[model samples]
Target chain A: MSLVFDMALVAGLIALALHVVVTRDGRGAILAFMAFGLLLGIGWARLASVDVALTEAAIGGGLTGMLLLRAQAHLVRHAAHPAALPTDRRRWLVPALSCGLVTLALAAVVLAFPRPAPSLAHQAVASLEATGLGNPVTAVLLAYRAIDTLLEKIVLILALVGVWSLSRDAAWGGASQLRPAIIPEPLVFLARVMPPFGVLIAVYQVWVGADLPGGTFQAGTILAAMALLVMLAGLRLAPQTQSRALRLMLAGGPALFVLVGFLGVAVAQGFLSYPEAIAKPLIVGIEAALTLSIAGTLALLVAGPPDRAPEP
Target chain B: MSAIALTSASLFGLCGAALVGIGLFCILTHPDLLRRIIGFNILGAGIFLVFGAVARRGAAMGLSGDPVPQAMVITGIVVAFAATALAIALLRRLASLTGSATLEAATPPRSET
Candidate 1:
C-alpha cells in the first residue's frame, strides 16, 4: 500500500512537470514550475532533510517564483508579445537523447556505489573534535575544504556582478501597467505571521549547525526569503546611488571565512585548522556573518537592478 | 519496511525523474525567455528530489539522515535561486533591448553576407 501511494505521488509530480514543459503560454508554465518547486520541497522532507526542505520551499519555490513573475510582467509591458514556442524537430531529438544518456549514466553510477567503502567521510566525521565545529558537514566545508567553500562564495558574487553588468544598459522605462497586482489581503496577513516564524527557525538552524543537520546556508536562505517576500509586496526600497552597503554584504561571507582561516593558520600552524581551544565560539561567529551575507546576496538578486526596484 | 520511509523514497525518485524529463523538453523547445526560466527551475526541482532520495538512503542505514549531503543540497538550493534570479534579470534586459519577448527571435547576429 505504501509503495502504491509513493508511486502515485511521484507520478503526479512528474505529470505536473511535463505539463509545465509542454505548456505554450509562458505565464502558465511559470506557475506550474512554482508548483513543481513546492512538490520537490515535500519530497525533500520525506527524505529526512527538514533543513533542506525548508530551504527548498523558501528559496527554491517562493523567491524564484516571485522573481520570474516580476520578470514576466516587466517583459510583457516593454516588449512585444513572445512568439510561439519553437517546434524544431532537431531540438526535440537532441534533448530527448541527451536526457536519456544522462539518466542512464546517473543510474549506472548510483548502482555502483559500494556498500563497503574505505570510509573517508566517516573518518572525517569521527575526527570532528579536531575541527572545532559541532556539525560534521560544517567541519568539512570550512575546516577540511575551506578553499572550495570560499571560492563558491566568490562565484556567487561574480554571478551577481555579471548579471548586473549585462542588464544595466537596457533602458526599461517604468511601464505603470507592468506592476503585478498588489499583495493580496490574505497573503499580506500570512506574510506578517510568517516572517517572525522564519526568523526564529533560521536562528535556531544556525545555532545548532555545529551539531545537527542545520547550518548558516539553510538559515540564510530562509531569512532571505522573508526579506524577498516583504519587498515583493510592492513596497519599494530606495535605490542607493553608491553601493557601499551592497559591497559590505557581498564581502561579509568571504571576509569572515578568510579571517577565520587565517586565524587557524596563526594559532594552529596550518591552514584552515581552527584552534582547539576556541573552535566552537569562533565557528558560531563565522556562521553568523555568513547568514548576514547570504541574506544580502539573495535580496539583491530578487531586487534585480538598483534602478528598477530597491529593497525597502 | 518502515512505512514512512518506504513510501517517501520511491515517490521522490519517480517524481524527480519526471521533472527532469519535462524540464529538459521545455528548455530545448521553448523560445520564450520566461518559459526557459521556468524550465530551468523545473530542472532544479528534479535535482532536489535526487538529493532527497540520498537522504532517505541515509535513514534506512540506521543513521540519522546524513547531514553532509543534506547540507550540500541546501547550499545548492540557495545557489540555484541566485542563478535563476540572475537569469531572469538577463532575460528582462534582453526583452527590453530587443523589444522581443521570445529569445530565439530577440537578436539576430550580424553576418558578412
Candidate 2:
C-alpha cells in the first residue's frame, strides 16, 4: 500500500510540475505551484523529515504562493492576453533533450550514492544531550549548526532590504496596504475567525520545537500568514515599514543572536556556545526571538514594499 | 551495498532528479519571468528532495532520518522563499517601470496599447 502511495504521489508531483511549466497563464501556474509545495511537504513527511515538511507546507506553499499571487495580480494588467508562450511547441525540444540527459545523469548518480550513505545522524545524536533538545534536527540547527542559522537569518534581512529598496525613495518606509480593491466578505470573515487559532498553533509549534518536529521557521510562517490574513481582510492596518516598533521587531532576533554569540566568548567556549546547563533555555530564547523577526519579515515580504506614503 | 538502497529512498531520489530536469526545461524555455522564478523554486525543491532521500537513508539511533540534512533542508526552504520573494519584487518593479515582464534587451519595452 505504501509503495503504491509513493508511486501515486510521484506521478502527481510530476504532473503538477509539468502543468506549472506549461500553463500559459501566470496565476494558474502559481496556484499549481502552491499545490505542488503542499504535496512536496507530504513527500518530506513520508521521508521522515517532519521539520522540513512543516517548513515546506508553510513557507513554500503558503507564503510564497501569496507573494506570487499578488505579483501576478499586479502584472496581469500588462498581459491582457496571456503572453505568447506556447508559440512553437517544438522550441521546447532541444531544451527538453538537454534536461532529459541531465535527469538521466542525476538519477544514475543518486542510485549509486555510496552505500550506507554518508551521514551525520550519529554525530547529531551524540551531541543531542549537550543541546538539551530531544529533536536531533533542532539540535543540529541551533547547537551544532548555530552559525548557519545565524547567517541564514541575516540573509533574510538582507533580502528584505533588497526588496524594500526597490520602491521609490519617496515611498520608502511607507505602509504596506494589503486592502484589496474589493474585499470579499468571506475573506474578511476568515480574517476575523482564523488568527486566534493560528496564533495559538504558531506559539505551540515554537514552544515545543525543541522536542518535536516544529520550529521557528514553520511557526514564523504561520504567524506571518495570520498577520497577512488580518491585513488583507482590512480588519487591521498593515504596519508602516518605517515604524520604529516594526523595525525593532524585525532586527531584534538577529541582534540578540549576535549578542548571545559574543556572550558565548565570555561565558562558554566561543561565539554561540551555550553553557551546557542552560543550553536549552538559550536555544529556546533565541528561537522565540527569531520567530518574531521571521514572522514580521515574512509577512511584510508577502505584503510587499510599501505602496503609499504614511499620512502626516 | 545496503539493502535499503533499493527502497523508497532511491525511488524518491530518482523522482527528484526528474523534477530538476523539468525545472531546468521551464527556466530555459519559458519567456515569462514569473514562470522562470517558479521554475527556480521547482529546481530548489528537487534538490531538497534529493537531500531528503539521503537523510532518510541514513536513519539511525532510532531516528527515521538524518537530523543534519533535515535541518539543512528546513533552512534551505526558508532561504529559497526569501530569494523568491526578492525575485518577484524585482520582476514587479520591472513590469511597473518598463511595461514588459520579459527581459528581451534587444527589443524595446512593450508600449502600452
CAPRI verdict (incorrect, acceptable, medium, high) for model 2: medium
Worst 10 residues of 2 chain A by lDDT: A78-87
Residue pairs that clash (backbone atoms under 3 angstroms), model 1: A134-A210, A135-A210
Per-residue C-alpha lDDT of model 2 across residues A1-312, encoded as one tens digit per residue: 787888888888999999999776678899999999999988988898888999998888889899999888888875333343445658778899999999999988888888767878888888888888998888888889989999999999999999999888788888877898899999999998899999999999998899988989989999999999999988889998888999999999999999999999999999889999999999999999999999999998888878888655
Model 1 per-residue lDDT tens digits across residues B1-113? 23433445545754565566667666777767678777777777777676566655554223446555665676677667767877777877777788877746343321210
Q: How many pairs of residues collide in model 1? A: 2
Docking class of 1: acceptable
Per residue, candidate 2 scores C-alpha lDDT tens digits across B1-113 of 45544578887898899999999988897778888999999999989898888999899889999888899988898899899999999998988887878764533223321
Q: What DockQ results do all the predictions give, each relative to the true complex?
A: 0.39, 0.59
Q: Which one wins on TM-score?
A: 2
Candidate 2 ranges with C-alpha deviation above 4 Å: A79-86, B1-6, B105-113
* Candidate of highest DockQ: 2
Model 2 TM-score (B-chain only): 0.87
- Residue A97 accuracy (lDDT) in model 2: 98
